[model samples]
Target: MSDASARPKKEKERGKGAGAPRVTARRPTLGHKWLRYLQEVRHELSRTQWPSREEWIRATQVVFGLLIAVGIYIFVLDSALSFVIKGVLGFGR
Candidate 1:
């Protein structure tokens, strides 16, 4: 049996007596809820493993290097395609 059911019958009925006000559920206010949410966000951020300065710099360098390499490849491909198209059309004449 549950803990409430285990209680004596007289104790259970005492709160339901004539003078007792019926209990109602209360919702949390907006400001109080926002404060609680901010507290939880701060707690989670504190536990995160942020990257070091050196790691961030290295990652940024790798991204830029790849971008330059891809740009060069596209530039070479476009130049070759233009030359081929020009030759086929006899545009040099």
Candidate 2:
């Protein structure tokens, strides 16, 4: 069941003799809703499992290495293609 459904309904049943406090539905202003949203985000962030410094460093190194390898491959391919094109056009002679 949803959290809202799990919670007891706030509405008072009729013929219940006790003069319970009347529940007033207060509409939250936009600013108040925004603040509440920020609070929820902060709470969720707190629950996150952050990687250790060593793990972060290792991940960064892997990504950087892959990027460097891909860049070198692209550069070499472009250079080879340009050389082939120039040779075909007799530009180098």
Candidate 3:
């Protein structure tokens, strides 16, 4: 390896008194953190492209149709399995 690659990286320096204790990074208060979050949310909201009502309705219908199809498939499979189970267990009686 090269000498540059073998050398260790230097860390960031913190200004503290020579005789005083070292100061660590401080976290923001709850209210200040919430305010900062709201600012970020508003900034993102300004850049969003909202879909039209008709587009939303069409998307909703597509999702609903897929859900209904899946539900019916599960119901049919469950009923078929139940019938098979009953037939197999009936010979014991």
Best by lDDT: 1
TM-score of each: 0.52, 0.63, 0.65
lDDT of 2 by residue, 1-93 (tens): 799777655444345446767679999999999999999999999999999999999999999999999999999999999899898997776
Candidates 2 and 3 compared by lDDT, better number: 2
Error of 3 at 35 (Å): 0.7
In what order do the candidates fall by lDDT, top score first?
Answer: 1, 2, 3
Number of the top candidate by TM-score? 3
Give the better candidate number (1 or 2) by TM-score.
Answer: 2
lDDT of 1 by residue, 54-79 (tens): 99999999999999999999999999
Residue 21 Cα positional deviation in candidate 3, in Å, after optimal superposition: 15
lDDT of 3 by residue, 3-86 (tens): 987665533223343467557988999999999999999999999999999999999999999999999999999998888888
In candidate 3 the C-alpha lDDT for residue 32 amounts to 94
Instruction: Name the runs in model 3 displaced over 4 angstroms.
Output: 1-27, 91-93
Residue 19 in model 1: lDDT? 65
Please list all clashing residue pairs in model 1, or write none if there are none.
Answer: none
Q: Which runs of model 1 end up more than 4 angstroms from their true locations?
A: 1-15, 70-93
